[model samples]
Target: MTKINVETLTYTQLAKVFDHAILKPEQTTKDVEQGCKLAIKYDAKSVCVKPCDVKQAADILKGSSVLVGTVISFPHGNSPTTAKVAEALQAVEDGAIELDVVINIGHLKSGLYDECQKELEAIIKTCKAKRSDVIFKIIFENAYLSKDEIVQACKIAEAAGAEFVKTSTGFASSGATYDDIELMRASVSDHIQVKASGGIKSLDQVITFLQKGATRCGSSSTDKILEEFKQKNSA
Candidate 1:
């Protein structure tokens, strides 16, 4: 959990909790560039770009504190394990410092636990072998999962060596809800932090998630959120 207190949170500290979302499929090169500039301007923790945008985002964030990140297997994680690893290898080579991957929810729900665990292990082992410092987050896409399923997923994530367990892909039927965030936090061990994603738009929403034990958020509204943080903290 982050040590930042709500009452004393600064815009800078708030910025560090954000993985500025640049994941829209419609985003052009110019859009990614603008997003990268925004991350740099706010000193955001990272620019969570599309896989194809990793190189560009990395170049833009080069020499800055902001990390360059991209999604693996993306909103739907139906790809074969080998395919995901190959995609991740290229993204890391393109300079991604972090990778958020969607687990094979179908496999998990189908009770194919061994297959799911093997896939996660392969992906994590492959990525870490190449980039030891890279932060790997597993997205549970919690909208489709029951509370017990969420806990099982978190356990799988920890056993497979993930650094964080995330909720939602935003492309889902619903986004990050407070109850889901709290439940995820309560279920995971301290070694595995929680990230609340999908539809996290405002400062109050971000703060609410943080108070519930999320360490980071993925958002397209980085500017609006931080500006509000600045104002509220100063007020």
Candidate 2:
């Protein structure tokens, strides 16, 4: 991964690194609307919303540079492979160009590598069938796994043809850490990207992760972080 030079970074370049999240269970439709507007205003790379909000986000973001993204089997990866496949297809059909699916954490922790890989393949295949360009990101929920398991999850995601491997679901016990990001970057080939999510609330944190090798970050603190960047860069 190329190093990110903080001194030369632009607001547009940094904003594009964020997948602004609005996935909280209790957030209302009004919140989704407002969130989408904020994302559009910032020209964020995408707005990651709850599965149910995909269509609404898509509608509001249509024709804008921001793309619609949604999560499947989110927060928990306990759903069956068939169910996950159906969810992915629905999300894509609803105008979600990106899908972030949680891996079956239990399966990986129990040494069920084949099961995990098969599930990822099935969902990826189903989504690609609907739209060939749908981006697939496999979320590891790294807080639940050991360091070795995190490495294993990275390999599994790469093998399953996922475009990115993510750190958490943002509801986990913890989120992305510097060590985990470096380890994930080292585990995968250069073509595969890493995304750091959860608990990131400042520009300094975002820049640190980008320099460590993350291509994207999931955060709800988009306005705060970006405003802080403006204050720093404008001085």
Candidate 3:
């Protein structure tokens, strides 16, 4: 659970909870650069970029407090375990310190728990082998999942040694909801954090999620959200 009180949250405290997103397929090099700048400007925890942009994002964020994060298997999670490992290793080698990996949604929906667990384990083990400090987050893309599936996914994420279990890929039909945050937070142990991603906009939303026990959020609206916070708090 988040130890910070939302009512008394400071700007820097709130800023650290965001993983500024630059993962849109249509985004270009310019977008990644701009995103990194925004993250640095706001002192965000990290810039969650597409796998291809990890190197550039890392270069831009170097020497800054902001970390480089990338997605694996992306919005879709149909990649084979080996392929996921390869993709993750490349991103890590490119200086990504955080990896948000999509689970095999189809496999989970089909009740193939073992397959999902194995894949997650393989990716985590392979990446950690390279960088023991690399943070691993498992993305459930929760919009497509049932409540039971979400709970099960949380358990599997913990079992697979994930540091966080995220709500969505931000490419889904729906994003993080209050109920999902509550459910996920309850579903996982304290060692595993809950990250509410997708459709999270505004200062109120960020505060609400953090209050509900989420440690992080993935958002493309980093500027808007932080600007709103700044304006409100300065008043």
Candidate 4:
């Protein structure tokens, strides 16, 4: 599909940009099934599920356009590179079409930039070799990083062949912000899309991020956000 202006998008168009999130620790298998149902109802781009729940989501959304996605080394990203890779491959085997793996935050904060870059490259290299069509989105968990750190992280992700550079894991102390989205957009080339996750619950926030160059957003309030967009159109 051709790229259109996210700023001037209609409600239906906006709905397609969301990756409906069901990653909360307390969410159950039934909750994931319900989330997949909602993603299909809203025409969402994908349903973000836990790694273990990939097969379940894939089975539920098999005939729908909504893709199955899962996180690896999530929220903290402290897992070793090999562990992350293994988790990613297992997710693919379980039927995940997209993988959002967190970057090693500790490595970045400790100035092990090379280590950080290598971790990403290792995952990207193997995942691509295994499944070339899989979407590899690298999450930075940016609330803990300075502007410079965020920039370096984006650079590393882009260099390592990430399809998108994400702002937060939504499990952090803070989430996506307008400034962070803009900075991330400016930091990377056009080929590397931006995904704003964590606390993006309002329609205005979603529009603001899209207008600022975010290609997609992660939201738990998927139905509410699209309903808000609908209300905006009718208003």
Candidate 5:
């Protein structure tokens, strides 16, 4: 694998790779607005906020190129498939440009790969049909999976036509690790993008994951990470 020097990435480039996430239900509209402002200020790719705030985020980011993203099935993937699909559709209708849906972990654990695949496919199909421009990301919550299971999940995600396979939901026991990122990268063909979410708390961690093949990042600490980069570069 080619080595990536995190220190060398430009501030703008780093910003483009971040998905400023605010998943907490308690987050107020002001909090969501602050997140949108930070994303726009830094030119981040998108701001991942709760589904309820998609329209608000979209309105805040209007005329800007930043995309709005929200979660379906959220931190837990135990929601019924129909509910997940409904959430995805509703979010898009509310102006979400990206939908990150959690894969059903219990189904996967039970070896019901087909059921899991169908659920993801249903949501993907609905999103695509409703709005061809919307992007779909499937979160696998890798903390609970074995290496082989992770690989299988990626394969299923690819088969179901998800644009990205994300690791963890930040509510899981663990977050994205170098090994897990590499494993995911190796598992899927180059056509699919990999997003690293969960415990990324610093610029170094983000750079490490990007080097390991993560195309995007999901973290609530996007502002802190970008601040660190600016300070380091200024020094």
Candidate 6:
């Protein structure tokens, strides 16, 4: 049987798994600030904003324990490796401590595994060599991949030195599923973490993923999830 020890986790422990969202292009500076405030209030590990708002999010999160994160080749993973590398570097310069980069889904689908692996390796190398402390999560956009493909991608991600292998971009057809999370956990070694993102809206879903071995949850519903968790535990 699967056992969950939610009571053993402090509020901060639950909060640190969140990667708050700031993905919309229309999101203003005020929006980013508000998101940062929510992340801090909930003690989230990071606030994930669009690349343009990385600096603003980082500024708002300053002095707080929250780390700033941003997406690269977001929503779509078709950008060249060089462009993604440049974007990741710029985000780091803008004070981002974590990067969630979308892997080239098309290449993976076409069986260009070498190219896909090389793309991730390039980004990992750049991030580690330039900013050793920064964390890199490779988003496989799992909704588009098969079960075998997911396992293969996890292997590639682990071999390429990515810190995490994540699910969807939330713009895809589907989001994180239990099957996908389990597949990722079973495929990668303990050294690599797993992030279950996309379509997570409730505390139950958050706990479900964490219990299944996901180290992080990416969602815009961070505040709502945390509120539900507190309410449930308090009652």
TM-score of 3: 0.97
Give TM per candidate.
0.96, 0.98, 0.97, 0.96, 0.96, 0.96
| lDDT score for residue 114 of model 6 | 92
lDDT of 6 by residue, 1-235 (tens): 1465568777888898899988877888898989999898889999999999988887788899999999999988899999998998899899998999998989988999999899889987897788899898989998789998899889888888888999989998899998899989999998899999999998888888988889899999999988988887899
RMSD of each: 1.5, 0.9, 1.3, 2.4, 1.2, 1.2
lDDT string, candidate 1, 22-54, tens digits: 888999999999999999999999989999999
**What is the RMSD, in Å, between candidate 2 and the native fold over all Cα?**
0.9
Least accurate 10 contiguous residues by lDDT in model 6: 1-10
Candidate 3 local lDDT, residue 219: 95
Instruction: Show where candidate 3 strays beyond 4 Å.
Output: 1-6
- Most accurate candidate by TM-score: 2
Per-residue lDDT tens digits of candidate 4, residues 1-235? 2344434687667888999999999999999999999999999999889998999999999999999999999879999988999999999989998999899998898999888888899998898888988998899998899999999999999988899999999988999988999899999998889999999888878877888889899999999988877776777
Pairs with steric clashes in candidate 3: none
In the range 40-60, model 3's lDDT, one tens digit per residue, is: 999999999999899999999
Q: Where does the lowest 10-residue lDDT sum fall in candidate 3?
A: 1-10
Residue clash pairs of candidate 6? none
Assess the local accuracy of residue 122 in candidate 1 as a C-alpha lDDT between 0 and 100.
Answer: 93
Positional deviation of residue 86's Cα in model 3 after best superposition, in angstroms: 0.3
Error of 5 at 13 (Å): 1.3
